[model samples]
Target: MNSGAPSSGLDTEGLYRVSGNKADQENIQLLFDKDHTVDFRSLGISVHSVTGALKSFFTALPEPLIPYEQQKSLADAVGIENEKDMITALQDVVKKLPQIHYDVFKFIITHLHRVYQHNQNNKMTSENLSICFWPTLMKPNFTDMASITATLVSRTPIQPFILHCPTIFRSRLEPNSFLQPAEGKLIDIEAEPGNL
Candidate 1:
């Protein structure tokens, strides 16, 4: 998807913000289900369709990329005072993800970081991408009504999480990876009342 996005979707105004044609997304999903090797550009698949399928794949997972028990840990790690400690804490939590989850998380975050790097064209900074992704990445463990309400009211601050990702996953990132250093000044979610 990242490979195709540069030529086809990265320059689009809203890469992941807009929905793709349902038929295109379904077709892509069907190909994926059949385990066929897909070349989105060759198939003339819309970038939005590819993105939609990517997100749908995550949402359909039996367990979210961030496991149920660890969601709060990730959120708490983001709330730590010191930036280095925060990165360490996040890394610790991420290290515990099942191997497949870790790999997929790394790939998805790297892809999103690439999309963010092209924000001038796509208009999707880490924050906007987080808004589109957090629910699927960090799902609630409970199914009961009370827990659901609590989960809704106190969701993870995925924007800050994404912003700190470069440091958090430094060891796992590739040398030429788009997961370059995050913004020079990390947003203090608590300090920034406007962000809250």
Candidate 2:
């Protein structure tokens, strides 16, 4: 009674872990693309669907420290005393999320700051920035949701941004086998009869 393709012997629970391994190899390709101070300490982790494609990925930085040139502007916007306090505030939020993988959490916070800066400079846009984190769990145990909520709410006045968690699912449906005929799609009925 098996009407579908044979199972590939892959465990669904282990799909994410395996996909993450492959993502690591792919990330190495980024190094060849451009030259920058590659922070090898920061690793990328991604989940894959049962179909063997990437679902989501995460990247992390050491910590959130505003550069000296931009510290004054960011401080003024957040109404903080100094850049050190700003860094501490960001750290506090990250500290609350002990259960979240370090890479993912850092990626989220880092992009939040980036968006905040972009808005301040009047460069906000709908296009997503190259962010490095993906939220996977529905209810993260390490960090309180209220903290994330508060941070997002506070930043709303600055610019639009998205926080996503990775998830992978299996689909049994297959794509269409053949392209549809396109002969009759165009409507040239209005053309002059002389053209014939």
Candidate 3:
């Protein structure tokens, strides 16, 4: 009487939360390959599709592993302005993250900065970034004792604000952050950091 494929309790209504297919595996490998370069725009990769692929890759891994604690520590360490200290702090944090998280986080740290730079040149906004990015890679709402609580609470798959809203969050920081000029100047601090 059933016309559809047989059910597998592993998935949801026949839809899998994660996939380990050949294509996905290749994407993941391409993402973190030490020798291979990953330029989304240069490679003609669709931003939306890239996010989907990243999510699939992350979900496909074994479970009971969220880097909430490690991510928090890393974030706090990265806050420090000292480069050497930051690297040491980052190393410590990396050691704390789960295996999958360490891989994903390292990949993100190395690659996401490029994506952010590209997005900046395109004048991409936070909402646009979210639409083009995925938050699962960074573990939404992740937290630990040493770091700030992750604020990625978006129901949408794309969560740039939580992931890294270079456009939007930067402005939020400007109004309150020390990046502003010590002497008051008649300029839009929120417009651009260097402009003021």
Candidate 4:
């Protein structure tokens, strides 16, 4: 295997030497370090609301009746006029919560494009660079994944690369299985296309 110091144009100090051959994992560690200046944006909901929602869902008594006042407030929050409308609204909120979180995460990640570009101009030493991304198991939004991939692919110094995605079971499986070109062909492929 080839090994050398990453090009001076890349933020070698920021890049952590991850154990596995996965770029996504390494990138995550690099970006999330406490000292890293990068900022993250999450869903706007308050911590109190999130905690309250969880508590209300898990701790409610069996066959419990919804307190009239609490039910009315929930209805108002969701823009519902009656009990049945409230149930539908609540269900919709529950269903959309995960999606909202993902959108927020994607927004934060997309903002990293500026950092990546800055690194490319100042620290890039190699003719080729690699980036890895792993789809979260909770809810995979193809649009967000595609957006992140597209942003990276559009950058310069095209080179041979690998994107390793672990199975939900954590099995190694096939390295080529989750890999694909960052742009061009719309279809998702198992590995980098020959052009890359």
Candidate 5:
């Protein structure tokens, strides 16, 4: 929202609203076009490479895949880190997310992963990219799912590809249980747990 660029339209019902003049808006809109951006291969559906604001915008949809209204609950859900709880919460939110939103999440994450491998050249990590794209990535609640993604990446070492997977972000407690912080007890043995 801080881009200061006028919003060309609003993304509602899991849609992307590209901001700018009509032409720029139209050009960015091609992202939704199956012919221009979508790709499906052995692994799964993929987004042909594209970069900059368009990619950022795709990742920064106004209505988060988690939904604007659910921010508070997400804190608890993401905190618990129980795979089943996380998965259940995510499944609930994802069901409410429009199909278009799902596609965009998939598309942006795919592109970001490819970008990460070469991030050294670009000097952008998942955390940095998420910040730069903050304007587009934020939700109405003034928070971003990317922030969570960055936290996950920083707390432990994981493949860049894993960072881009919506499922991982949605159901965060994977790869050595990073999603759920350490819980309970602080006897001599428990002095300072990592997740605490």
Candidate 6:
């Protein structure tokens, strides 16, 4: 994701709000399927294409990124009224995530937070990003009113989770960690992309 999103991505007004060309996104997806490591620039892939591919990847996962069993727990955590309690409850829910899910969630949320920081150009605030990602991250069974209500409320967490990532996932994001916010650097869009 970092490979194709640096210079142009920062200035993209809609960012994830817009869709990439279908053909271009499909090509990127094929490349990813063949090999996890893809050179985005070699194929002249656009940032939108990369972002689209990312969404596709998550959507195609056997289980939603947040997982079915944990959705209610996450929603309940987000519903906490107190700020500190909310963060604490959120942390507990996050701790229960599968390792791979937790890692990917942390990485993506962290990246989105950084993007939100440059919203003057990208215009993708945490709220906008949360809205965009809510469906992709989890899909709740809307079998009943309670489940529907819980899922609707669960959407609230995506924004706060992205904004308060450091506080919520402090243990996973230790000093000098790869997921550390300070470690983030701009990807040179002009340069050849690296493998994931």
TM-score of 2: 0.23
> Ten residues in a row with the worst lDDT in model 1?
187-196
Q: How far is candidate 1 from the true structure (C-alpha RMSD, Å)?
A: 8.7
For candidate 5, which ten residues in a row score worst on lDDT?
Answer: 187-196
Give the per-residue lDDT digits (tens) of candidate 3, residues 1-196. 1101111111121121223355644664566465344433333333334344555556555442345545455456546567556555555555676665544443443233323344444443334443433344444544434223433223332232223423322322335333233568322211111100
Winner on lDDT between 3 and 6 is: 6
Candidate 4 or 2, higher lDDT: 2
Tens digit of per-residue lDDT, candidate 2, span 1-196:
1101012211123322334345554554465236444432233222232112222212222322222233223224334446456444444433444343433433333333333334433233322221111222122122544334434434331111132111100011123201111364311211112210
RMSD to the true structure for each prediction, in A, is 8.7, 20.3, 15.9, 21.5, 16.4, 3.6
Please list the residue runs of candidate 2 whose C-alpha ends up more than 4 Å from where it truly belongs after superposition: 1-81, 99-101, 108-153, 157-196
Q: Number of the top candidate by TM-score?
A: 6
Query: For candidate 6, lDDT tens digit of each residue in 104-160?
Result: 888788777767777988888889988888778875557745447666785555887
Alpha-carbon local distance difference test for all models? 0.67, 0.29, 0.39, 0.27, 0.37, 0.74
- Tens digits of lDDT, candidate 1, 1-73: 2333434365567887889888988888787678655555566666777678777778888877777767767
Tens-digit lDDT track of model 5 for 1-196 = 0111111111111112222244433444464453443221211111111123354554555555534444344344445556666556644544554566644544444444434444555454665554444334334332556445434433321222224344545443234332233464111111111210
The TM-score ranking, best first, is 6, 1, 5, 3, 2, 4
lDDT of 5: 0.37
Model 2 scores a C-alpha lDDT of 0.29
Q: Which stretches of candidate 5 lie over 4 Å from their true place?
A: 1-50, 55-66, 73-96, 142-196
Q: lDDT for model 4, on a 0 to 1 scale?
A: 0.27
Instruction: Give the clash count for model 3.
Output: 0
Task: For candidate 4, write residues 135-165 as lDDT tens digits.
Answer: 1111122345432343333332111111111
Candidate 6 accuracy as lDDT: 0.74
**How many collisions per candidate?**
0, 3, 0, 7, 0, 0
